[model samples]
Target chain A: MEQWRFIDFGLVDIRDMMAMDEAILKGDGDNTFFFWTPKKSIILGFFQKAEVELDLSKCKDYTITRRISGGGIAFSDDRCRQINYGVVGTIDNDLFPLDIIESYKQVCGVLIDTLVHYGLNAAFRPINDVTVDNKKISGNAQTRWEGKLLQNGTLLLDFDIEEMLRIANIPKEKFLDKKIASIREGLTWLDRELGEQRDMEEVRNVMKKKFEERFHVRLKTGTLSSNEKELTKNFLPKYYSPEWVYR
Target chain B: MEILKTKPGIHKARGGLIRSFVFVENGILKDITISGDFFLFPEEAIFKILENLKGTPVKREELLKNIEDTYAKEKIQSPGTAPSDFTESIMKALEA
Candidate 1:
């Protein structure tokens, strides 16, 4: 059985978080499962333009940044109750598939299992979403560097729908076309589903265990390596610059 | 010389919602920027696709051919998006 390094990097800033994620992908290290939360911020998909996806005037209260992964926009903050986790590793067909869609199924299945352990009726919605009661609880995205792959997902513990809507410029017609009626109808969170706020540490424990059990690996608690730290230092400037975020 | 007009269009593709901001002058695509929640593999290829489409005639057939050529050249592996989906969004922007 392979051994994976598990690091819970709780509550980092959005830019440093992005830099660290990229550093881990590019740096040589053990296959890692990383958990973190960002200080209040809105993260955009790599391809999304800030002007199109965000109401900049209404987003004054939150930091706006773009991640290197391709997917939909997401709002993250510990206060709003969101947890983020990333799985970084080289391509291994037996462990994780090479195909993008198939890989989403493989990684998202772990999330579904974690949610199920908490007694939520969770399911994997393809491309990349984990849903409970047919409403999305998690959205995931991926990016590749050389032979390495980094897939990260946002798990909503308790969502602030109004805040999200205020910052994000989602079209009302988008909901109508999906027959979703309203944005609230299309999203759900762990607290909403369970009727109580789950302890963050407990949730993290469950995810660590689920990941270890499902993949038949031992998760040794570890921190970023020296090389990863150096790479992150080099990458930090790019992530912090307005040129990168607004471009 | 015609004034370049930036027209916006939105389309919900099988993959995800795609938005296109096309700058057209005299029925010629001067520049374009495609943005959306859709996933495109080798993600940087989107820029190349846009760069390649500059100065393309805004007609449906011509737009499709240019985009298709770029898709093929990039060896794009977008799961739910195809060249035609982008072309449709771009065409919508042109018409708008």
Candidate 2:
């Protein structure tokens, strides 16, 4: 069986979470699932130019940066409301399918099943998303670096709609164009769906069991090695730098 | 010569939104940057799309044909929007 290390991290800087993934991909770490409820923050896609996607003034209230992978911009506020997930491993990982689309489908498939277990009618949306009633509850991004693949996404246990809007969901910038209400239309939250907030730990435990079953792997509790910790420190500056985030 | 700028158009396709911005000089696409909330596999493929458009005549049909041919040969998969959708955005920019 493919043995995947599972690490549940406490709230950390979003950049450190991203940097740890990079450190893992570089072989300083193992194939693992890194879980963290990030501090209130916004991390843009690698290719996303902040000017077009985010409002600068709004970002001052949050920790803003970018990830190495590409996808839509994401934000998180309270830890209780968001559970961020990352799948980090080499391309040879048995958990990942060979085809890019299939890889996305596989990961999102497990996500759908996991959400379904929560009594949420979740379905996998093509490319990289999970939805309920056609509204996204999870959005994902992936990167294949040489022989390594790292897929990171968010799970919205609960999301503050107003906070999301005030932060400039570009398409939902109502002040600029109320008619372009696509973001809100497409997004949803677990709390909103269930009409009650479930304990975050209870949801996380269930999710861990679901992941273990989906990949047919044993998830042993694991954390950063000293080497990986040092590497994350080295990688932090890039994620924090304006040049890299703006690039 | 005046620097040309295409008004950004956000096309909501199946997969997601594909936003297009076109820059033209003398009826040729001097530069173009297509970005969006859309997901593009390989991510780097985006730069290649932008690169292929460089120096191309800024005609709707021509730009559409270029991207369509490239997307087909490259086996490009954009879930929501099609290559034609991209050309349509460029066409709007051309009109403006």
Candidate 3:
């Protein structure tokens, strides 16, 4: 089994989480699976126009940052009900197949196996989403920069659709005429599926075990190196700056 | 030649959005700027798409073929957005 690094920095601010991602990708780290969640924030995809995709008036109360990754915006909060993780490394056929789609399939396959371990059935949707009974439980995005790849995503232990709607303009122009029921139909959470709230530590433990078995890798738990810490500190300002968010 | 500003045409594809700003000259795409909430892997594929459409004819079939060819050449992975959706949006802009 190939060995990889596993780092868990719990419940960080959005900026540091963003910086941590870049630090690991910029430096040499064994194919790493890193996990973190922002206390509460709305993260915009790299190319997403904030004015077009979000309900700014409602979001005025929270912190907003744009991620270097690609995909739709996701609303995360202090609720601590969702688990987020990313795989950072160069692709090798031995670990993850080189094709982007296949790589997504591999990572999501690990998630699926994890969910199954929790007694729920989950499947991956094309490109980058995982669904339970066709309702989204996870959304993933990938980026390849300077030959290094990063695929980051979130797995919802539970979510609040009302809160999600408040933060996003996902509703159509005519959607105001309808109720929020359809939005709920599009997404689901593990707690909802299992009919109970799950502890975050429990989820993390299960995820670690699942990833280990699925990838055939012994995850050697490690913390950020001094060099990575220095890099993360440098990236912090940019990640937190309005120039990067609005740029 | 200075290009005139025109209204952009927007289309909702299967899984994302596409907004096309097209400047046509004699049925040729003089300049096109595409921006939307769509997710694309490698992200630079957006610039490549815009670059490939420079000087492409605005005709539906021709534009579709050019877009498809460019996407093929770039090995683009536009998960929810497809070349046909982009071409259709451009055609709508040209027609308008």
Candidate 4:
């Protein structure tokens, strides 16, 4: 049986995290965990073409990067976002895709428990999204490699909807006064919903506790190994290059 | 000619983002237009790349390779902008 681990990093780059995942896939380290990113960033899906999904002119003024997993594009920043990543070994191949979906359920259960603890109505939505009162609060994506599964998700602690709308180039008709109001009606924030602002550390602690309780495993704190550092150095440039980032 | 216009699912930013229109004629890629708010260095360079890519087949791997090679020659680092970005955007449009 493999042991689970928990790591909390304050602010890190999406590129570094991608590199670490690549190293883990290559069998360079044990299963690990960490979360850190600046206030504003957009991570594109692995197979996504960057030009079509992002306003590159707008992104030039912000931090944007490509991720290793496949999914839709997502925006995250300091005030409204926290990243939680988990890597586990000892996966059962016989389960295949079911294991992948079940993993989401297990992790989302922790989030639901934490939200319930905080007195918020939260539940797991199918195919990888967590919602509160039928509005999305978090979106998750996953990638598997060599008997290991790396699942990570973004929790919306606080987000700037206007900024999100601005950076992503939302359709302008939606910007009309009443239309914008209608759009806002469909979105919710944790700070607003909970009636209090929650800091990153507080959220991290709660999620860590809930994850341990739900998975029935102990989590240890650890850092990326030397091999991981080497892998990242080589991998970062490739990931950052147009070859991988665009195509 | 079969022309299809669609949003590239890969790039997630909202406004003035690039949209791809793929033109296939006789089962071959006749042309593709990647238009939006992205900036390309030496703006005309994008048109030049597209002009050259006009007659290529609509296959995914070939399109990716040609786009990659063309951008490498231009010394353009990020393709998420104009021409190169347009190429990637078109590929994603085709996939979707």
Candidate 5:
């Protein structure tokens, strides 16, 4: 059995997460787990052309980054939101094209167990979403490299519909409803559902325990190698540039 | 050249804010243009690649293969439009 390491990084740049993905894909790092916050950012999908998914004029006030993984655009902030990344070795090629659905289910299982531990209702939704009472609480994305998989997702600890609506190009009609009924129908947050507050640190601890129990693996803490740091330095500028962010 | 305009089906709610226009001349791809407000990394590089592919033919597999390669190298983030979607949209437009 191979050993897996879990690292808790309180807050990090979205670019660094992406650079780590690239490094792992290039076979530079061992299978690892990463959890962090993006200091208020919107990360767009790899293939999603920027102009269509975002309102540049509105996003001008905030920083934007493009993720190497495939998924729709997502908004991130300091408020109760936690983003987690898992870099694991490939399981089997027979499940080629990668069983994205199964992978999501495995991760969501840990999340659901954690939510249940807190006495909150959470369930996995098809395609790639984890929701509470049909309202999305998390969105996940995955990418493969050199027989390894990098799966990452966002857990909404709180609600930020105002900022989400502003950055994303939601229909005007949906925005007019002051109640945000439509948006509310699609999204749910821990703060809203539990009527309490929780930060990334708390979320991380609960998640860590759940993951260890569910996967039946011991997670050891570790740091990036010198090679990874060098790669991150080179990748950061490119990721931060308008070319990568707005492209 | 036939200029085909169609809603990028993936994102239809925002008045088809994601637009893909492929310029085909007699079944051959003269040029391809993917324009919209969607967030894509290295935005300018998308157009540059499209411009470079101007003279290429409209073979579906070839188009997808080339685009994927160019995207990896340029690190253009917009999954933009898939080749199958591109081919279907263009075929629909040409027929119209």
Candidate 6:
């Protein structure tokens, strides 16, 4: 069987996490499956305007930045135990299909499998969301650079709805078709779904296993290569700059 | 005849919600800013569409055709949002 590198980058600053994603996509590295938790922050979709998506007055303490992928806004915090995972590899491989929607389905399928293993009825909602009973538990997005594809996602172990509402300016139009009246009514987390918090390491293990099974590859624990580290270092300033974040 | 005004419009298409802020002056599109949670391949295509709409007459059919033309030229692939969705939001902004 083929082997893919797997790295668990425990906890990283949100900006550094964004930088690393771009670095891995741009650098020549082995196909990688990485896990990490980001420090408190609100990550904007590539196309989103921060001023329109965020209530800046309430986000003074958060690290705000825009990711390379196009999706909705995402809020992550290590304290809340939000877990993140990414799969990065060259487009030449069959692991990720060339069609955007098809690839999203394939990547999000892994999350659905992992959730099913936990006895939850998780389903892949088109575009890029994993939902349990129609409530979103995870959101994912992807970006392609040259020949490489980087798809990253967040799995909410627990969500602070009040905190999220305070910082995010989720427009009411987004919920027009859905029965969702508020963010709380439209979201579910592992902790709330299971009635308890699952061990973080245990959850990561399941993710690693599901990814391997779905893609038919072995995940070998590994770390970032020298090239990836250097690229990440070079890319840090862009994430830290207000020009990119507010753009 | 510089009567500049900006208005916000929001619409939920089959694929996702598209929100737009349209700036108009003297019944002509001055500029437009489109942002949303929807996924658009070659994310920069939105800007191209905005540029194409500038100076367009503030009419539903014209706005719709310009947006459609940009999508065709750019080969825009927004899974959940269609050109009509964008036109709807932009038209809504103008009407507002």
* lDDT tens digits by residue: candidate 3, B1-96: 221246556677754666577888897888876646667766777777778888887788888888788788888777667889898878777766
Question: Is 1 or 2 the stronger prediction by lDDT?
Answer: 1
Question: Once model 4 is optimally superposed onto the true structure by TM-score, how far is the C-alpha of residue A135 displaced, in angstroms?
Answer: 0.7
Docking quality tier of model 5: incorrect
TM-score list, all predictions: 0.95, 0.86, 0.84, 0.69, 0.73, 0.94
Candidate 3's iRMSD? 4.0
Winner on TM-score (3 vs 5): 3
Give lDDT tens digits, candidate 6, residues B1-96.
111234468788867667788777899988778767887877777788888899999898998899889988998888878888988988887667
TM-score-based ranking: 1, 6, 2, 3, 5, 4
Chain A TM-score for each candidate, in the given order? 0.96, 0.91, 0.92, 0.85, 0.86, 0.96
User: Which residue ranges in model 1 land beyond 4 Å of their true spot?
Assistant: B1-7
Error of 4 at A11 (Å): 0.7
lDDT of 4 by residue, A1-247 (tens): 3465556656666666667667665656665555655445677765445665566777775556676665556677556465555554446543223355566677677778878878988988655668788676776766665566666677777778776666664544322422344445656768878888888678878877887776666678877778877887888886567776765
DockQ per candidate: 0.56, 0.32, 0.33, 0.06, 0.12, 0.56
For candidate 5, lDDT tens digit of each residue in A70-182? 66666875563655555454546332234556765776777788788878778987556788877778877766665666777777787688777767765444323324557
- DockQ (0 to 1) for model 3: 0.33
Residue A234 shift from truth in candidate 5, angstroms: 3.2
DockQ of structure 1: 0.56
Candidate chain B TM-scores, in order: 0.90, 0.78, 0.88, 0.64, 0.60, 0.87
How well does model 4 score by local distance difference test? 0.62
lDDT tens readout by residue for model 3, A1-247 = 6789998888888888888898888875668998887687888888766665676787886788888877777788668778899888777765676777778888888788888888777888876789887777998878777676888899998787888876775635212222335666677898889988888888888898999998888999898878888889889999888888865
* Highest TM-score scorer: 1
lDDT of each residue in B1-96, candidate 1, tens digit only? 111245567777767788888777898888788778988888989898999999999888998899899989998888888888898888777767
Q: Write the per-residue lDDT of candidate 4 for residues B6-91, one digit (tens) a residue.
A: 43323322222455667667757786665443333333455566666777787666676677677778754232243334555566
Candidate 3 chain B, run of 10 with poorest lDDT: B1-10
Q: Model 2, range B1-96, lDDT digits (tens) per residue? A: 121234665565555555667777898988776656665555667777778988899887888888877786676666556777777767766665
| Interface DockQ of candidate 2 | 0.32
